[model samples]
Target: MIPAAVDAARAALADPAAVAARWRADHDGPVIAHLPYDVPAELILAAGALPVAVFPPGAEQAQAHLQGWICSPARRFLAAARQGELAWADGLVIPQICDTMRGLKGLWQFLQEPAFLESYNLPRISRASARPYFASELSRLRDRIQGFTGRTADDGRLRAAIALCNAVRERTALLFQRRVLGQISNLDYYTLVRASYVLPPEEMLALLGGMDVEDAAVSKPPAVPVVVSGQLMEPLAVAGLLDQCGLSVVGDDLVDGERAWRTVAEGGDPLAALAERTLNAPPCAVKNGPVTRETYLAALVAERGAQGVIFLHFRNCEMENLGYPGTRDHLERLGIPTLYLETQWGTAAAGAVVTRLEAFREMLEGC
Candidate 1:
């Protein structure tokens, strides 16, 4: 029997809009959708609303609205919005972390015209100086969210939201640890992770907190251990492919996976704490932080005793492309076998990806 938590997570991800509609009915508050690579969910929660991450499948029709060079996720998000797939959402937060994302804000504003539209400006460089600025930006976001919801995200509410989010992160980290230890399957682990993006944080906390990973009926994790570094993984099949090829993801720097759950805000001031959390997060490709991706991956691999490294990236994601060469070179120097695969989100290219992964796994076994 499927565990209730896993089943609910799968159902939620399968139909995010439906889930959002339910949240709207339950909370009587706005449902705000945000693009990935970091938008503060706590602020939205503090405003008495749900924060949903946009990760739509397939962008075939979205091509008409976007240039050919735009990344698949951007195209998919636009397509989803165009198709009324996101009609349940009352607001949209577009984080301007890169050129493509910056362009998306204008398209969304002109086309969709959500009730609440926010263009969040994320600092590319993570530094001490950036924290205060980011905290101010977060404050602005809180004000905007309050304006949309007619509910003030006051200091008390913000602190409560932070505590809830921190609990979710802690629970997620435990699931990840179990997956690395082969106590849970990849499907179970990732479903919960992705589902957290769509489900209300309070709901997610209940679901994850109630999960009994020890007693859940789950498939064995793959035997070959590896670490995956990338912007994100989508369409679910990419993670499934790792399991299919007998490859276990012992560690990752993927935005949607490990990176999402790795940190907790620390401080009495909620916005400043959130800023500190972002600045201190594991290195991200879009953020030119003090720590390099290569160094982070190396440390993760060593800490987890990974057998190999897989650099999976979304095709046409320029920010991820910029850091791949340096990270790959650094790992190669350390004698870490690395496989880099770039695929468009929701494309029928898993066959090609799996073939390459199989060869990489075989090479590792031979050694």
Candidate 2:
């Protein structure tokens, strides 16, 4: 099954034409706009829309259009959208995850050629108010989805959507468990998991269902197992740098990685389930639970048997960066070595960043 899943996933990766063909055949109705992280899958499914994440293809010329002033992740998303890579989208739901994303939303709203555009205003990350804020935002989002689709978000419809989303979440959580138990390499897991965002959920599930879970092989245990925490959208290069430097990231608390699909809300009201699922997932910078960011990082490290922790922050991510000093100090008290890397999104080069990672890895090994 793992081999089959690998084969299916590879098919999607190998032939763009095939993937496009499958997408065209399988996807009916409007494609919900793609964002980097934390868009509720239930909303898209309830509205009968496809949730696609927008990302650049890592080509120099493709990135040239984003040169100067604009942050890398923003440029990459914009470049991809502008180049008609997102032509399939019938409408866009842009979540204001960060300042660059907020700016990108404005640019997209202004520039796109007559498509439905909705902006999602996320609640500020805090320990006390995040859940209520998210619940309210979800309510607003449900209304907007109903308005756009010309359908009402009745209780029955929402409950059915919640059940379907719970299934997807369960499947995703199983995959993460397999990875966490050392049944799969981080590279293979990352490839499969990252592709989930861009591909349709059914296709992703099909691929996952086919993966060889039993008798799965594992890579050599990393000398330094690290838990990556905080705001990370396009951290492909950063992960690669860590890998190159002999530090294996066994787990992550980022929306794009392990945290993206960890929990399911079972039984009870649909809205309540939705709220539970959102709050119970790994910590987000925008979370307002009683759990501090430091607690979240320490918990992940402990659960995953990580040797150290790396807090990767994007430049101008005011909330996350401001909270870093405290987070670092708390991790230190726990006897977990922590490293903070402040980077401009999209500007991280694997080779250059690997040097610092290597030193960090050595520190972990010595400890």
Task: Give the best candidate by lDDT.
Answer: 1
TM-scores of the models, in the order given: 0.95, 0.84
Residue lDDT tens for model 2, 180-282: 6666555556656666666666677666664444556665564578888866635556755665576767777777677667554656667656766656666
TM-score of 1: 0.95
- CA error at residue 133 for candidate 1, angstroms: 1.2
Candidate 1 lDDT, 96-179, residue by residue in tens: 988988898899888988788898887877877898788889989989999999999998898888888888888899888778
The lDDT for every candidate, in the order shown, is: 0.82, 0.67
Question: Where is model 1 more than 4 Å wrong at Cα?
Answer: 212-222
Which 10-residue window in model 2 sums to the lowest lDDT?
58-67
The whole-model C-alpha lDDT of candidate 1 against the native structure comes to 0.82
Q: Where does candidate 1 clash, by residue pair?
A: none
Worst 10-residue lDDT window, candidate 1: 210-219
RMSD of each: 1.8, 3.4
